[model samples]
Target chain A: MSDAEIAVRDLTIRYGQHVALKGASFEVRPHEIFGIIGPANSGKTSFLKVLNRMDTFTAGMHFEGQVEVGGRDVRAWRNLYALRRQIGVVFPLPVGLPLSVYDNVAFAPRLAGVRAKADLNVIVEGCLRRAALWDEVKDRLNALGSLLSGGQQQRLTIARALSQKPRILLLDEFSIAVDPVTTMRIEAVLSELKAEMTIVLVTNLVQQARRLADRTAFFLMGECVTVAPTEQFFLRDADLDPRARDYVEGRFG
Target chain B: MSAPPPHPDTAALDRRDLAWYVDKLVAVLVFVGGVSAVVFIVGIFAFVTHEGWGFVSEHFSLRGFFGSIRWAPTSTSNPTYGALALIAGTASVTGLAMLVAVPFSLGAAIYIAEFATGRTREVLKVLVEMLAAIPSVVWGFIGLSVMNPLIIDVFNVPIGLCVLNSGLILGLMAAPIMTTIAEDALKAVPDTYREAAEALGATRWQVTRRVVLPAARQGLLAAVLLGVGRGFGETMAVLMASGHAINLPTSPFDSVRALTATIAAELGETAVGSTHYQALFALGIFLFVVTFVINLSADLIVRGIRKT
Candidate 1:
């Protein structure tokens, strides 16, 4: 009944005796910028890792969940690679690959069998431009990516992710270490990218979630207290639940 | 303000202060040790270059140095002392060792460092360290006992001490160095790189081939350099396995002598003030320079990776 691009039902994650997420459920709307806001150690990373099937929870520490992206159960998909190709990710830290600037962006497409030089050039340039990194690094495509500044490195990482031409982009604190100006630049880029890709942001900063998210999910103690449109979630949280009221009133995290 | 907290705090500080002073002293000692290592290496290069310049630069010395195949520097009739025999031996042994050792050692290293975990990784590290600790003389004794007979009789390769035997010894000797260095390089790679590759749905082998190895390129080069240097500089194992022949080895089955062995073999009996003695010294120069160049190349490669 919901027009959700991604639907999570009966989601639960446990790390040994510690429960990370209790029976969590949420719907991510298509092409919407969805923000996940939680304090440190609140299972944001664990949840994101599960979504990508990157979590290696011990056998006993099971995740009881169903995650469907584009109406296909993510776990049941016959080809995980095909699913991944449609959803790009930028990690919390800038994972600048040990490759030349151009190759970092060229890697995925090449792996996916886009071997034509002309197509590669177009893809790399377009992604870099979308990442707002083209003008600075256009002349140094052959240089090692590690030589770039922290901000530039993050942009390059974003460019690399974009090269996958994903329908969904997952960002985990993409601007955490960069300068404020660069953070704003990335936020602007995400604003534009949302028209083409469903953007999911995991952040600790409330102001950031309010600025960029169309809908926001507030998590506390491994539970989603509520998730609603950004304006309603922030303005109408006082009467929703005690935890939500305290969190919204700034009395607690 | 501090006086108010003088109950238990002052005594705690007094205890910690002593530990802090000792820690500072330990840090100073470590700093001095690091600098001394640098000074020691630099001094050796400077001293060797200063002493061996005449031989290194001399046209006659260098020509007779690398171009000939002579080992009887003490032979009264004709003291032949050309480095060709030694260079040929070193090159053959090192090349063979690399061919056999590089792929196997790197594969094992990648398996242990990137793939293995828990008790398996710990066991691998312990095994590698133990192998490295096994003394050179023990390796020489191994070649003399277990390896020597196998080559001549069981293996039935002609010239029991030949390029093949020497190569096998060098390969085994270089294994620990290769695995340890290569594993270190692989470990130095950030875990995030692997995670990113995996998140992109790359299989284990594909991730290793495409992401891990390329990221660990500088370290892998260093690892290879360390392996080659160990094999080239190794004297006793090669001496025991090689037939000490001065001629060119035509194949793996043929006998050959390397430079390190020649130096070891000739240095003891060369009479003082004889041309044979000087020529042996010249061989020492060649061995020293070659090892230095290998180590230098490793340093340059690591630097090149950093600059980019």
Candidate 2:
């Protein structure tokens, strides 16, 4: 079998005495859409944060077990910059930095030592195009990113994530601040993005998972209850654990 | 559920009775107290300008006031009141103070806000507050007794009382305020900016330089402006540490006198209504205008930053 793009084994996360995730393990295949659906505080965001080591910003966060990307152990990597550069994350809210729209998308590339103005222009335009935000902001590239509409800001953030040229993209409720039309546009963008990199999508909207995700995981409390292909989970006699079936059916969360 | 019993005495009192009148009376008194502060500031401005009216009416020459280098106001023959020397002195001392204070306080602010954690940050904050609480007279004494000897020995100068000496003391006085205000500004930047920057592979230093500082630019600018205002108006420390010479400072080591120091040193000796006294009041007017312009420009810049 081909190696998993991301492999996790008994990943446990804690904030002081509070356990955020309890020995959860999963794998995501390359070029596939992996959806994580859970109620609030079920560790979906925490799990995404751990992928790019963004959780280090939180005080008193403790982690156990292993997370490997492309067969390399994440913890063993000494250069966090190089590791994080390979993975991108989009947050729930659209937090456009207080910078020009063009500069916002060009930020990552500039950080990675891309100094040529021509190269930056290409990267910024290309990323904006892939995020489906190019037409709306093409004329206002010099305008402040904070001035963009909420939906446009969300797309700008996605464009910024793409600018990193990440191998894996983790999105946490990216459509929460996005309208349905923008959401549909982004869903199309995601379908295109999966051809280039693996996508880990954590969503509150279960229907988003049904439409996009090739594989789905259900989380409850702090435990990942099940991981199955999307079609099998939707089947009536799908051999899923009864609780997973009830959750998928909207009987109880 | 049963209704709770009401107090008979409370029930008899109307909402708009004596208690309400007392509340309104207290509110008006507090409002008047707040307004009194503005009144006092305006009153001082008016009194100074009124006393200095003679200089404005008769002796005011833009060239004589600002063009000449000498500041021999008490000369028996000519009584030259040229402020060019004094202005140069004030600029050099205050500029030196800013040069020393800005980098030090900004670094301290960033360290306290972003790098220091928990017990360290709390202890540093308390220490900074204590530094701010130290009286200007105490700082002046320290500069005179301790810093003077050290500067004399190190630089091998004939005298330690110079623009550099006054500047260093003023810088110390401004450091605590600048650091405190700048730290508050840096801390006010949302955690989300840091998180987003970090997720994009930014190191902590990079995030601080690129994201945090730019986000807090307006507040940081205000912090620098307030520091300048504090240094510009400082008197006791400059009066003690500076040599009180009315000469253009050629170098950081040259003896000089600031406007505030001039006012502090000579105001007591000048008679009530002499041209010298009026000139001093005129100096007060200049100081007020300079500080007002600085603060107003800073406000404009902050507003401009917000509009972007």
Candidate 3:
């Protein structure tokens, strides 16, 4: 109702016989940071993967119900390339393709049909700057991306995702390997980027959701328990589910 | 406070010692097996060089080795030990074989790794492996019986036993090795890389060409190098398929003798310790060096890839 950029209605995901996501319904509004928080095996990362159809790469993944991205059903979209171009994903562990830092960021733009070196240079620098990585990597752009520190590599992954100029960015536990300082820096960067695109941030840390998310969804045992404004949920209103409150308060996973 | 007393686990320690000793014994046995390979190779190298040293010291000249044009080693009065023709023959045939195999092997590897799935992929992989198991003599026989006549009919050559015939046979023999190694290299690439490429809107082919190939570049190079080594060392196939004429082939159609073929054809009959016999050993030495360098480089490339 509030001009959702992505809408999922009764979505369920399974890998072989095991259900990873069960009957989840949610909406992410445009230009807002939507946070998902849950314990292990709660389908948080799985939900992020389904946004860009990244789950198709895995074998025997089954999905039911509907997922609409930018007002079009993802299942009905014939052009997978066009669909993927609109949504970008950063994996939990930063996998910078064993290439130079510049090439890692430029890879998406080149695939998106930008061939000119000058054009790629501008886009690469702009995205790197936006990811808070330009300052550290500006001098050694030719160095291999795999050679970067954990935090820098995570930021490089962010820059790579931003290079596609996606309508929505999906992050899966991006700070799992990052130090606290770098995590805070990336949070600030994401906050600034939300003016241009919607962001789906899946975190194991509830405090991260409390700090950065405009709206938050709490998932428990493959089910979405509740979706509410971050302030309302964290302030412990009577409407909040007990399990969600317990999880947010660190009473138990 | 004093440190806590140690627990009584002497019996457990004794049992662990027994297991450790057994592990050490097995490790030492494997180590010996590994060292034996080096010992045998060094022994072979010593024997070949020792056997060829007399001819090398007396009759070996730079002019006859690299500069001379003819390779007639059986002349009664004036036997020429010039190997430029044989070396050129080996190069041309191996080059042609590589030319035929590289594209096909790489294409098959790409298909197997990127396109083929499930049973189709398994079948294709097994077929390629089975191709490697086929004896070289069988391949040579096929070249002689089927391919020769086909070549003659297609090209109108008087005799089909030429460099081209041997090259084609060698290419077929080498393709399986190339494909297996290259496919392994492609498959070794992580799925995360593919997913990363796809999430950025790259098509399957684009991901393969841009990401997978570049990532596997070193491994692919090692594969090609190993294929070249395999083709260069092959004896029975080239001996039976090639015309074995000791001539400098001006074109692919001309009959020529490779170093391995020359060794196979003449080494059995050459009188022991004669100039001809030693020259054959010299050719063996040359083949050993070339293949050694090729295999060593391939190993280095593979190691570098593993390190990265």
Please, what are the lDDT tens digits per residue for candidate 2 over residues B205-296? 99899999998988899889988988888889988888888788888778888888888888899999999999988889999888878877
lDDT tens digits by residue: candidate 1, A179-242: 9999999999999999998988998777888899999888888988788777765675334666
Model 3's lDDT to the true fold? 0.91
Query: Of the pair 2 and 3, which is ahead by lDDT?
Result: 3
Q: Kindly give the stretch of ten consecutive residues in candidate 3 chain B with the minimal lDDT sum.
A: B9-18
Best by lDDT: 3
lDDT of each: 0.81, 0.89, 0.91
Candidate 2 colliding pairs: none
TM-score of chain A of 3: 0.97
Query: Model 2: what is its DockQ?
Result: 0.69
Q: Candidate 2: which docking quality band?
A: medium
Query: Predictions ranked by TM-score, top down?
Result: 3, 2, 1
> Each candidate's TM vs. the true structure?
0.83, 0.94, 0.94
Compared with the true structure, what per-residue lDDT tens digits does model 3 show for residues A40-158?
A: 99988777777788777777887898888987788888887888988888888999987899999999888878999999999999999999999999999999999999999999999
In order of lDDT, best first, we have 3, 2, 1
* Residue B217, candidate 1: alpha-carbon lDDT: 86
- Positional deviation of residue A23's Cα in model 2 after best superposition, in angstroms: 0.8
